[model samples]
Target: MSVSSSLTGRTLIVMPAFNEEEAVGNVVREVKKTLPGTVVLVVDDGSRDATSAVAREAGALVATLPFNLGVGGAMRVGFRYALENGFDNVVQVDSDGQHDPAGVPALLEALDSADLVMGARFAGEGDYRVRGPRQWAMKVFATILSRTSRTRLTDTTSGFRASGPRAVALFAEHYPAEYLGDTIEALVIASRSGLVIRQIPVAMRPRAGGVPSHNPFKAAAYLGRASMALVFAFIRPKSIYRTGSNA
Candidate 1:
């Protein structure tokens, strides 16, 4: 995918981080290298480390939240920033360095026909093989979401995604503020709001540092909470999410 020719609209890459000092800098640098001239914004979720400073030094625009807003909140801030700054396209890349920067163009290329494009590690060949109960939960949610949205989705919990202007505006207004906010809830919002969702296979690297976001217990609870959120999304009026976009 040739991002240079495909991205005629202004683009912003949003990286939400929490205590990702060890990884954020290199992630920022890699993103800049992959998509030169595209704005990279790091939303520091009140990290107690040098994450913000390192990200700034790496040449990214930084926004430090006064407190931890979780990934969803941090990303909401990013969407708002994108909208306010006239960015027509937005991409969410995890700051933990798990997402490969080279796969960015695939998402952007998919965006040519999709309102939102997700980089699905499980959709095709990938290095990050999810296992155990979490893997089971992902499959269950993927099935449920695909059936509900009438679109096949292999990775319902994947955070790697690109959004168009309409998605950027609606999500900036009412993004889910809970666990799996960046993944399940955001996808539900986009589907219900009339956005076309597509998936492209992308490989991912392991986290650079820190523990995984969820343990076994939390993963189960996440499935339960996500189920409830899905119910709410289905009942919500679709007209409420409609936004004007030239694209």
Candidate 2:
């Protein structure tokens, strides 16, 4: 089924790009083809390359950031754009071409009964060519998150995901600003705030170019910090209730 026919509301795909000139255009094109009528937005996170221009040429509405705001910052900008511009659903996908645009429908389909739908690379028959150490670290983090959040999460680091109105509002208000732990963070926050979260297996492609931003030291730091963040986030009382009415 086509994306337009599947979705009951407007769906916007947000690509957070940083020096991804080579892949942005193709990524936008594939998303447009797979999800007809889906609007694309490229948040150029201070890319020194022609990422913005390529995305624009490929039919994405480009939003340029002044400096490198990291992935979380770029996604926050996209969330704001989606919220203010009145998009009913928002999907955050990377511009590095590792995420399959064709699988966007699966994510969207999962969103029908979930407040947030996350793509799980570990759950399906896909060539998940992740580095050994990074994969191990992700597994560890996923275990910790699942325990703390009282939910099962196969891929805590997957970036291919979709969010509905409640999630859009929550992220726009309180998405983490730094690091690659936003997936786990979002899941924990959503669970605490009583938002329904679901995950579906999706294929993840090998990265196209440039070294993956994660190294051993960086991975250690991320694991430590993300674990701490999740602990604090779990213990802290939620300020917002699950009900629509804010009491």
Candidate 3:
């Protein structure tokens, strides 16, 4: 897909940080390097470390949350900020530096035709292998999401994505609040609300610093909660978030 320069300055890159002090600065710098003039906002999810300071020093805006809200909650805050601040687009990137900044252009370019564009690691040209219980859980969740939403998505739990105004508004109001929630549940919400969702292939790197957010040990618990969220998403009535509703 050809990338357009229209959303360059208007887009807001939302990076949710949780004790990612070591990686936040570099991540912010990398995003700015990839997408010049784009606004990078780091949502400090009640980090005990210097994540906020580091992000701010790295030439990005920072919104420090009062307490830890996990990835979903932090992303909701970023969405709200984007909505209130008059951004035309929003991209979700992990602060741990696992998500490739170079993919932001593809996601933004895909956003021209899609309300939401997911940077899928597994669906891409190269192989991004997942092993153990986490892999099993991801496959199961992907199957459930694809079957229910009727959209074939290879990476259901991927955090790398870009959202147009329609999706940003919807998610800002009622995003998922569960532990392993945001990415999958938000897609379901977007699909139910009549927004177009698409996925593009993107490469992912290992976390630069801090521990991986989800591991095999937590896979069982994540699967349970995520299953419940998926079920509720399907059962819940569709409510489209209209443009300018929040204005």
Candidate 4:
């Protein structure tokens, strides 16, 4: 079947947001504008602001969590929503607007050959650079994950990604909710589960609005947390999903 065939009426954009009211609405609009008729589901991870209302006004389907579950929890909800609603492809986009909606098609198009496709920022596409311990940690994790998954992955910490049918089904049942689990550990889970993983170069932007998570001060904390994420990923067992067509 054609790659476009897999995407037709079967793709969903899942934005797991927390306290991103300023950018969520515009992000939603951009997704809709870029991919007309596509369903954009904003999983509001217990934002204290009017994120839900803004998202609705921008023409996105909002799912509000009672409390913040971080990116991993919110994403599991997205995967489940895709499964329940007959969507065969799930694309993860950051609500902070760092992930360009324009790059989504390329990621989805790569789904033609792989079960999971990630948008890699360091693949010579973007000038978006990280420094200090965060950069060191990302490089180490990427090298290890590239070996683990048996594919070269330059940006394992990237939040921009797309998952095909089998991946959606598997993640719905088994995606992790721990810190850094959504990005680093999730790739490990997919790789161990026998999913075909691939990544392409894409440019990321400075966050539209909000405090940056990575900085020199927090570099040490990130290194420690990232190391633990890898440990947890290795200890976690893998599985196969044979539940049906989606699987």
For TM-score, the strongest prediction is: 4
Worst 10 residues of 1 by lDDT: 238-247
> How would you encode candidate 2's per-residue C-alpha lDDT over 1-247 as one tens digit per residue?
4466547247788999999987889889988877777889999999998999999999999999999988888898988888898887889888888898888887877887898888989886596756656667778878876775566888887888999889998887677665753666677777777788887888888776645667766765665766666665666557753434343
Tens-digit per-residue lDDT, 1-247, candidate 1: 4578347348899999888889899999988887878889999999999999999999999999999988989998999999999998899999989988788888887887888888888876676786766787789888988876678999988889899878888888877667675688778888887788988888888888766787766765765777776677667676666655322
lDDT tens per residue, model 3, 1-247: 3344567778889999989999999999998888778899999999999999999999999999999998899998998999999998999999998888878888888877889888888985556797866677789877876765677888888889999988888888877767666877787888777788888899888889987777768766766777777777677656434444532
The clash count of every prediction, one per candidate, is 0, 0, 0, 0
- Each prediction's RMSD over C-alphas, in Å, is 3.0, 2.8, 2.5, 3.1
How well does candidate 1 score on lDDT at residue 127?
A: 66
Most accurate candidate by lDDT: 4
Off by over 4 Å in 4: 1-8, 239-247
Q: Which stretches of candidate 1 lie over 4 Å from their true place?
A: 5-9, 237-239, 243-247
lDDT of 2 at 99: 90
Tens-digit lDDT string for candidate 4 (81-199): 99999999999999989999889889988988999999999999979988888899999999999999999999999999999999998889877799999899889888887899999
Quick one: RMSD of model 1? 3.0
Give candidate 3 misplaced runs (Cα > 4 Å): 1-5, 239-247
Q: What TM-score against the true fold does each predicted structure earn? A: 0.91, 0.89, 0.91, 0.93
- Please state the error at residue 52 of candidate 4 in Å: 0.7
Ranking by TM-score, best first?
A: 4, 1, 3, 2
Off by over 4 Å in 2: 5-9, 129-133, 235-237, 240-247
Better of 2 and 4 by TM-score: 4
Q: After superposition, how far is residue 179 of candidate 3 from its true place, in Å?
A: 1.5
